[model samples]
Target: MAEKTGNAFDLNLFKRLLKFTRPYKLVFYFVAIAAILLSGLAVVRPLILQNIIDRAIIPKEEELLLYFVSLMLVALVAEVIFQFLFVYFANWLGQHVIRDIRIKLFNHMVGFKKQYFDKSAVGRLVTRAVSDIETIASIFSEGLFMIISDLLKMIVILGYMFYQSWRLTLFVLLVLPLILYATRVFQKKMKAAFEEVRTQVSNLNSFVQERITGMKIVQLFTREEKEYTNFKQINEKHKKGWIRTVWYNSIFFPIAEMSSSITIGLIVWFGGLQAAQGGVITLGIVVAFIELSQMLFRPLRQIADKFNTLQMGMVAANRVFAILDTKSAIQNNGTIKLEQVEGNIQFNNVRFSYIEAEEVLKGVTMNVNAGETIAIVGATGAGKSTIVNLLSRFYEINSGSILIDGTDIKDIELKSLRSHIALVLQDVFLFADTILNNITLGDPSISEEDVKQAAKEIGIHDFIMSLPNNYLYNVKERGAMLSSGQRQLISFLRAYVTNPGVLILDEATSSVDSYSEQLIQQATEKITEGRTSIVIAHRLATIRNADKIIVMDAGQIVEQGNHQELLQIEGGYYRNLYEVQFVSGIE
Candidate 1:
């Protein structure tokens, strides 16, 4: 969330945004030059009109009329060309700036710690990357350059009006102060409204995205009407936010129109009186003043609107910069590199907490030698999954140390540390891509032949070959096209292909069918071969053959032994857990 700056134009934010445009300054300079030319050309038409009326037509000089008309036509053609360049290059620069920003924003998000994502909404982040950035582009395309051009035109027109007749020019500007005051008020109110609208858009997007992704759960729980009611509440907020902006627009534009009419009326009355007195004002002067008044006030009216665009863009930039400014707590300061690790692991008095003052891992220490299979059995929320997260350094631990082959895991580069370890979680997530791509993860070094060989080694090659397109079969979104069992097999093949020095299976087969369980068990045997492995499971049968079993209770290790060796204890936590699971057939 971004804090409100309350100013109509945030100068600091604007300067920061201007930094992204530096790479395309050549195009932007061309746009600025075009706007300058267009502003100068805009006043030529009215000057030519005044000359035609007073000098050429009234004096009956046909040749002078033809000459002035030709010049006017030439000015019009040049104005049109400049206008085209202004629009084209302005938009071109805007698109390129947004492209660079979107990439930077995405790359920043990719490096954010997992804890940041745990609290942030996915759809909100997407909105920032997509819609909010689009609004920023409009600041260039329809806001900044246009406002500058309009301001320049107004200044030139005002200068021309004064040169023609200072008395009439003063009359036309009599109502200007009132319009300026009203515009100031409108800008402040509209800035707040646009900010509210952007916030509601993010909220609406988040709610809709969450509901759609979890639609199956909603339907299973018969929450259709309930969810709809919630959606309507959020949608209503979104509507009200825009309506507020619309209301401000409605009030301000009418005030501007009435003010313009009053100025024109003043010009007519004063000019008419001056003419009646002693030919002090001409008909040509009055006509040209009318045109000049419109040209002057129209951009003033539109400046208010374009300022709205500028403010919205500033608001969006503030939000995006807030994200970019967020520093991830998980710093990767290690420089140590290893071609291969021996797979010995240790947790020395490790302690952790997802939230402050409520520890999840409490001074639990463990060790595993090379090529040893360790099973961790614990009740739900006993910090089983937290161990895997800490091991991978997805979240920083509060105290104590985790070591791999006598090297502090923190002392090793994150990429080097994780590359030697593989994790196969309980819920397998596959991208909307081919089976081969999911298995190889687009790693060109791991070719099709490598994937097939690994899958065959894990006993899933036959199952994949039976599919419609075999290795090329598309998994669709989140692997929706495949069964949970089939997705699990793919995950197994994915892990096997990596051939990591250490493997961690966090309830990998706990939710699969009996047949899938049998296949996964076989895959597990091949994957854990000659590697250090940690299996976290609720089913006691899965870890029956583990070299050592560590029983956990309330975030602390209570028992450690092989399965049979621990099951023989009369009332040990492991034995009781085994009996309960065996009797309930949860194994």
Candidate 2:
């Protein structure tokens, strides 16, 4: 594993962020044009005010003053119209960019190697997808618009002020050095606070999600009081995070406001003195300088704050991009399609290890003829399930080759390999949907007749029919409405309907009751006929009739033969397991 790096808000991150909006460049161009035109009105209206004071109002020319005032009104209206267009387009671009980012993140996550998911928590990934993305979206919309408009307004106003009277402009800008220094200090502190807030939000979201998903466990243990205490602690952390952010923000505005007040006061006092001494400062000049003074500090303040927003956004982008950068350890080889398969499988010197130093399968070789039923029994963590995962290409083998019909499984396309195989996992996962949907998952195009036949074959059709809505009855999330046996039966039907050439049953019968297990055993015997099957079980009696049984211990096969052959060795683990069950029955 690579060491984690904490370069969350680096310059390169901004470059990557720009790439997301590259597709919508035209929208950005339109927004920029509208912003410039709107900001130009800011400079123009102030000059119009100067004209009224110097040429019309001071000379007692009401008619001329009214004329210039009307022009100012027209400029203001135009500015409002352009402002509306700018806002609409900026928001549209922001939302579309966010949509693209989410789609990219989702596609990347699903394609990630199983190892990434094994190491990452579900709640953390969920928060990255939702809360983190939303934070970046806010920066895209509000932050971008404010920064651009403010920058343009400040630039144009400063140029106008300088052209009118440099002396007055200098007076207003006297506080510039202090403001810059203060802004830098505040922005750094604010960014740190914002980062803390972002982390706390994710933690709170993750806690809530875990509580809801594990509500049953909580209720079973009656830990509602404990859970509430945990929630309160997490919530308090979030509260403190926000309070720190507010503390930083609250102190910023007052300093900027004070500077603006001092600037305004200085301009009025100094400019008045200059005008009294028959200097170039006029009432109109003073008014324009004061107006432009406000324009200068507003954008300056925004520029400071925008940097903080960009910092938060960069942290979010780092997480999102980190997911996007992950490469899947297992990837499709060539496009190998099995239009027709004989179900023959061969494992040649197969070796696998989940971790580097620990070997799970060590140079084991086996070959199964087409349509053969093979059972693999082993102690827990003996790599029985690992072999099945390899067959499905869920995890790549460390060193070995798995062949289907004499062709290496890696040579075959992953989609084709998986499509030809069906897996009935021990833990049945049903969606929050109707029973029909769950059964039809294996083959959505299956006909009603086929569905009914598959269901009846698993001996579940009658039970399903007894329900209030039969197939349409909702299963609830995770199939909570049904017993464990019913869920297993439904899973069996799903696999049976697929009619796959290769079938893997990994503890598929463990959850079913004895009666249901008998029915399942019978149904599965018929289903595995003329099809390759790999059965894994802990129960000693479940795989007794298997064509071959391979017993494993400590990642190597210790026994391989028929059930009677294994039983002949009375002291072996399999024999011991069977005898223990036999003795328990006598009691």
Candidate 3:
């Protein structure tokens, strides 16, 4: 959640949110006109009731009474129709506006650099895009224009009340300052309370999302009771935040309600007394004043509740706009799109960091010749994966340059640069979708036959065919239905179908069984043939046959040569690393 300073009702944020209504200006006007019509029509029935009491009922004129009754019925029906229009159009406008904002927000989020996502919680972003956006929609549906309508109705009724009898209206006015004072206090308190509630909602959402996604870890460690206790605390805090807002509403509305009821009592006592004492005030005026008093005070009471809606909307808008205003997007300024890239890649003394405090890649330099297979062997934080991520433009390099085919990657169009590369990560993610769709990812350019051919070339076709639905089998969420090695193979097939010029396997064979390793090794050789490949691995045996092997440690390349040449160096980094892995069978 984004923190906004100053007023809780942010006028500037409200204006920015309303800018989405530009495309639907006509609908906006229609909703506004309906509100105006509603406000004016609200006074119609009271005026008719006054006429019936004074002109017909007082003189025992039954026909005249029926006439005024019919007139009142007409006014009621008109009020109903316009009220329907006001609500329906207001909601319709809100839906369309949120549709645009949601699309824009999702598009902006997708373009952000990987580091931004690395630091932010997925649950909070989901809240911004989904539920928080829904909160802002209420601004249009029930906040701004509706508040305007209610205030307008109160003004018209108050004006009528004064015209009828200023003496009686003065009593109503006497109690208004108290209503206004309580409403102001309530609005301010609720504003802060709602912000707290929203923050807690985001906290709850994040906790639930992470725990559910990592349920296997919790159950594996047998920490269910501990996590349950944590959730209970968070949920209880959320309840307390909401109850504070409820407590304010409980205090304020009754104060408002009591003031209105007292005003009505005063009008009855004062107006009835004057009518009996032979003053200008009549029974008809008293009746009209009673109806008019509710019309005046009810909206004054609701204005506070409407301010709650407005305050919530401002908070939601602040958070959403914060996402929209992020400068974390990759600066994709390159216009050069290469139809065929030669796959030669170079990193020239690159220095990069996801955060300022720690540099993940420190002045590292390397080269991969076109059609050469290079292996990077290093410890966990050796910057092996960082090299590939920078090459893929997933994160921007802080210093130095990366070039593809002798051209600076920053000058190569991002789509074009990425189109020439295929990456199969260690932790393969598959959507809950059919195997074929996962491979093609719904790309129309890649036909089903093309997928099958690529799968067969990688030698995983027979394994896939053995399944019940073959290529059509649903892999379930994160490929949960598939074994670890099986998911890796699917990722390979997906990368292969793209037919990229460069291939990257980031520890692709480290976590699989021996049989799957052999299968993956075969697939690797098939895909890397005549293509530039950067293989990151902890298993030293897998990359022994590469054209070159680069040894990295602590974010720097310490050694590089062919495997036999590096092994020939006395107690070299590669030799030492190979010895440890060979002896222990794990890195």
What are the TM-scores, per candidate, against the unseen true structure?
Answer: 0.97, 0.93, 0.98
Which of the two, 1 or 2, has more TM-score?
1
Each prediction's whole-model lDDT (CA): 0.91, 0.82, 0.90
| lDDT tens digits, residue span 369-409, model 1 | 99999999999999999998999999999999999999999
* lDDT accuracy of residue 58 in candidate 1: 80
Per-residue accuracy of model 3 over 99-155 as CA lDDT, tens digit each = 899999999999999989999999999999999999888888998889999988988
lDDT of 2 by residue, 1-587 (tens): 11123442466776677788889999878888887887788888779888899899889999998899899999889988988888788778878877889998887787666767887778889988987887787566777666788888888888888899888888877898888888878877776677788788878887898899899899999999999999999999999988987888788889999999999999999998887787888888788778888878988888877767766776777778877776765787657788877889998888988789789999777877788888998889888998888888888888879999999998898778888898988999999988888988746588768989887865778888988799888999999999887788788788888889999999988767887787778778767888999999887677888888888887777888878888898698777767776667621
Error of 3 at 363 (Å): 1.9
Please rank every candidate by lDDT, starting with the best. Answer: 1, 3, 2
Return the clash pairs for model 3, or none. none
The runs of at least 3 residues in candidate 2 whose Cα sits more than 4 Å from the true structure, single-residue gaps closed, are 1-9, 276-278, 442-444, 447-449
Of candidate 2, the 10-residue stretch with the lowest lDDT total is 1-10
The most accurate candidate by TM-score is: 3
RMSD of each: 1.6, 2.6, 1.4
Error of 3 at 175 (Å): 0.9
